[model samples]
Target: MIKTFVPAPFTTHPALEGGGILHGFFGRQGGISKGIYDNLNCGVGSDDLQAHVLHNRQVLTQTLVGADRPLITPYQIHSPKCLVVTGPWPNGESEQCDALATTTPDIVLAVGSADCGPVLFADADNRVVGAAHSGWKGAIGGVLESTIAQMEALGAKRDRISAVLGPTISQKSYEVGAEFRETFLQHDARNSVYFAEGAKEGHFQFGLPSYIVDRLNACGLAKAEWTGQCTYLEETAFFSYRRTTHRQEPDYGRQLAAISIT
Candidate 1:
């Protein structure tokens, strides 16, 4: 994997600016994988060549933090589980969790997702950071809340933490059946505001990013914003699960959103 092929990640977040912390929302570029995976495919669980996946991970880790620092991501299961990391996990070990929080410097906490929202959190004042894979299920299950709680347990303050949600599928591309809308409404009637009528009957467009940001704000983290990039709509810049499915692709690659305390 050469540097020329890899596009630099789009960095954002007011609290994380000024080199106080290192983070990026990486898309589908800059690696050796071919075919549908293309390049910079960071998902280890994808069926792409394992060697290419490892190389891509190495490229991203080196670019985001440093070649000397360690990068650790969990085996995401869309659960509310959050892990607090003090040190890097051993090679070939992944905890079954949706989010990771850490206070250790140079230890990168990362999460992978294609269509799902990848959230990066930083409490620079407390020297704590976290990353979460927030799909509809994970978001509904309280993954963001759990991540904030875990960060707080590690000395992060709710008011001091800044959360930035990375690129994900937007409402225009996220159509669901009536049952999907009903499920959310059953959880809370207020959640109905997150959905809108679709082009066809018995379907609705879901606003996942807004819902996630609303959750973050409700949790006391005043600073939270989406990058305003839609993975499904931005074909050249992102990998979308719905887009892949609509195209009838065999498999799709996942993107990485990571953060590390300095």
Candidate 2:
């Protein structure tokens, strides 16, 4: 039987493009899933049917790499763990890491996210590429930094690495309690710049994308940019964990951001 495929289109950043590489920030479109997963949900950890998720992943691999190539993503646990992708793991959910880097060709390195910052990195001069999943915890714990280090080990240089942050929750939609603000402040008092007073007395809105971008810039990459797209706001196009929690839904789908050396 022929598997039907919808047009799983994706967005690209100039920083990661035109360097003998494949990169994309995919949304919730052009897949075979249903209900909350709608379409193109590439997360295997979600409660969505395993077959549907696998089908979506198969299509995702075909789109980013080739039908014969592989797409590998880690079993994310919101930590700073990063791995160098030397080969594809037998199970997509078996490797437990939040970020990945590789000098290998033909395999797509990807991370799943819904509002969390999905960061893609490439140093074409070195033929090294990386992908990272950075939520608030991962960001504070240094996942981005870890990813950069891993890529550099594979011969990527900081001055030549181009990083791009894909869709994430914006400040307006990311109100946090005073304790959350305190957490950032404790991590570094200067982090106050990423928070703004929320409507509530003890809450502040957090700027996730900007914070992630700032962290990348601090690493001295050649270029770092946020797509300026908000996953929480674009309901129809992207899946969002925070948005699902707001509506008291059981679970939400996860979009994929991936990169690879051609």
Candidate 3:
């Protein structure tokens, strides 16, 4: 059986309101991908068998999301690109984007992540939803802001949009050299708050989801939250790029965070 993780910190808008449901940050717990990508690896880019990945997605659709709903994910090129999906786009098409938005019911907006942040946004008042994959590049490039604008274009109000960030690599496990820290601080001095002192000399730990939340709040959304789960710290629960590097693994699994209107 597929075990779906539920986001406990977020409150689902009343089902009567026509707003869709958002799932928690899911990890590698239930599919059939073997070796390093074992169990519940939804990333098509991974070396996992394409058939196994498809089966895993099917399991997620039937067990976690309703069987009738179709999940939609973008190509995720770590850019600020956002696509407005009215219906299902081609499945597994690497279209070179990082975000998706839709107002259609039973149309799931999904984002895959190993270390990057998966942000799910919903506006119950307008029945609009969006998802974004926020890596450092995408986040700095304004993917989250672009997603909100796309949702607003679909009739969602900025004040009515609530964004939830799924599990990602927390700061303590995300050590970076001076150049990486300078990249952010040069963009905006306020970004300093998202960095902390790392264990290594002249290095800093970057807070991935914290920056994500800051961007969401700055967009004037109703609420912005993070699940506060660390992918690198929790070996059994999530897949992490840094963790894979530490263990000398070939490739890591990718978890899926999805939301769909019913």
Candidate 4:
């Protein structure tokens, strides 16, 4: 059994600060995973030791909502699906989805990401919270919107909700091919603003955080803001898939962005 554990202080956005909601954008520090996983690797899907991942997740849950409640993060496949969770998944069995919303207090709704956007949502007035994992694929496919829809279904008004995008890949470090940019253009021509010239002639850098927050803001939520921390650049504090790939490492860790209604 895991002993009582506490993690490093996590990042929080002003919009989500101090409410009936307990929320935090966690980094990859203060965990027990070894080697490439290092510390605070909450991804059960990673190649890290199952014991370490489970222990880290338990630490995160305790940090956010105490040890009595459960923290649930579904299997994210870069799709736009969002699940409305009324209770903890049975015995830590997670469903397959990219986002989660809940009216049930004490259940920590979390999303895991490495370089991709980890968005946490809250409507303290309605005692509802949501969390989403939005990679470029999920963002374009509408996972953020899906989360908002579920929140609304649980009595959270769009105008009363606040969302925060946690540490993600910054445009400067996120070079992409022209075909990737075209996917956004085909969806909406105005999305060009999220793309900038990459170092290479045929490549572009994508602004994932900006795009995710923009989509959230367009939903007419009370507030949506990015924590302004880049997972790629903050090597000592966060885990980044792109950074790991660039280094030719075998695997990477995923950080959690979570919210619990109280």
Candidate 5:
């Protein structure tokens, strides 16, 4: 079985209902990449060999979705920009966006992540789906809201949309400097609620998923939940940017979170 970490509030698609599947694969246990990427490194941008990355992606797609289903992913520029996809985009044509949405069936919507959050959204009623790559910058810039708007544009009702934030760096492992905190507060003083004092004097712990959840709720989505798996703290199961930096490793792996209607 593919033991994915799924959020409790988001309902799984019933086999009989055929609503499609929303799921994510944690990085670490499988694949052919070596060195800093170790095993199961799916990130195309990483220093890992393209052949190895392609093989890893192929393995994941076969094991998770199916043999022939292509996983759709964007270039992920850490912007709030979103793309409305109708079908499989041409191979190697990267979009300069952080989010993607579609109302079509069978094509998998995918996003890559290491320390950042991979957010997946679905509306079974309208057959609309979306995926987003949310780093601190993208999250603060309203990537979540942009995704919601795109889904609504595809005829998805806000009240029927269900979203889940996959594994990411939690507050305990995400220590940031004073300037980082200020950048958020500059946008809204209420952003302080997502920050807590860290061990160091000038640093603070940032709650990434909490901010994501708050944004989803603020957008009036009927259901939003986090898988609550902290990437930095769980080295055996996840790849973390902070962890890689701490070890002085050249590059790190990335996990894929995906959802599709079929």
Candidate 6:
């Protein structure tokens, strides 16, 4: 039998509270991983031991749902692609997408992230839930909107969907170059409000969470909120890609944010 472990310092959102749904914004705590990966590292794509990664994921799913219910995650490639999940994929089979939505109860929709935002969505009225891995690329590419659309197709109303962003790199830790700023401005001049001068010249501090919340609200979600946690800034609570890159680490673990329709 696979050993069961529990996550520590898990987070939940008030907007998602009281629904017939169970969700968590899990941090990088509780598990058996070691070294740079530490414990509770859930990134299957990371360099952590494959067995350990599987065990960690198992712990997360079992804690939120049960040992019988499987947790499903996509082979995310920072795209806008979203899929409607009806049942568990065959072993070693995973979809190539960034977001997943389902009305099926007990099954968990999971998203993995380091510095990227993991947003959980639920329309309790219709028993539909979704999870998305939104980096700057996925955000700009419309992953959030795609997830909502998929949920709507699965009988969820845009006005009833509640979205909450989990731990992510806040603007203070997200610095970008001139080209990046130019791209957003090119997308929409209003996007400029999300950018501010960085400590270094020619660089801007990007507000990814704010931008994501704006997108969610504009997409007609009934409620939206950022947990106000920064992956890079909160070393104890999250794993940060930018921090790892800054420290020039060989690899970094990924945290999980998941939701299930009860």
Q: Tell me the TM-score of each prediction against the true structure.
A: 0.95, 0.96, 0.90, 0.96, 0.91, 0.96
Q: In candidate 2, how many Å is residue 85 off?
A: 0.8
Clash count of each predicted structure: 1, 0, 2, 1, 0, 0
Model 3, runs deviating above 4 Å? 1-22, 90-92
Measured by TM-score, how close is model 6 to the native structure? 0.96
lDDT (Cα, tens digit) per residue for candidate 6, span 1-262: 2554454558998888766899999988877889999888999899999999888888887777666478889998999999999778877588999999998887888999999999999898888899999999999999999999899899999999999999999999899999999999999999999999999999999999999999998987899999999999999778889999999999999999988887
Candidate 2's residue-wise lDDT over 42-77, tens digit each?
888899998998888888877776554678889999
Give stretches of model 1 more than 4 Å off: 1-7
| lDDT of prediction 3 | 0.80
Question: Where is model 6 poorest over a 10-residue stretch in terms of lDDT?
Answer: 1-10
Task: Candidate 4: list runs displaced more than 4 Å.
Answer: 1-3
Q: In candidate 3, which residue pairs get closer than 3 Å at backbone N, Cα or C atoms, i.e. clash?
A: 7-24, 31-40
Error of 2 at 67 (Å): 2.7
Model 5 agreement with the true structure over 55-96: per-residue lDDT tens digits: 777666666555447678899999999999877677757677
RMSD of each: 1.8, 1.5, 3.6, 1.3, 4.4, 1.3
Higher-TM-score candidate of 1 and 2: 2
Q: Write the per-residue lDDT of candidate 3 for residues 107-203, one digit (tens) a residue.
A: 6678899999988888887888888999999999999999999998999999988888888898888999999999998999888998899888999
Higher TM-score: candidate 3 or 5?
5
Please tell me which model should have the higher TM-score, number 1 or number 6: 6
Model 4, 1-262: lDDT tens digits are 3565665569877898666888889998878998899899999999999999988888888877766567788988999999989887877688999999988877888899999999988888888889999999999999999999999999989999999899999999999999999999999999999999988999999999999999999999999999899999999999999999999999999899988877
Residue 220 miss distance in model 2 (angstroms): 0.8
Find the 10 residues in a row with the least total lDDT in model 2: 1-10
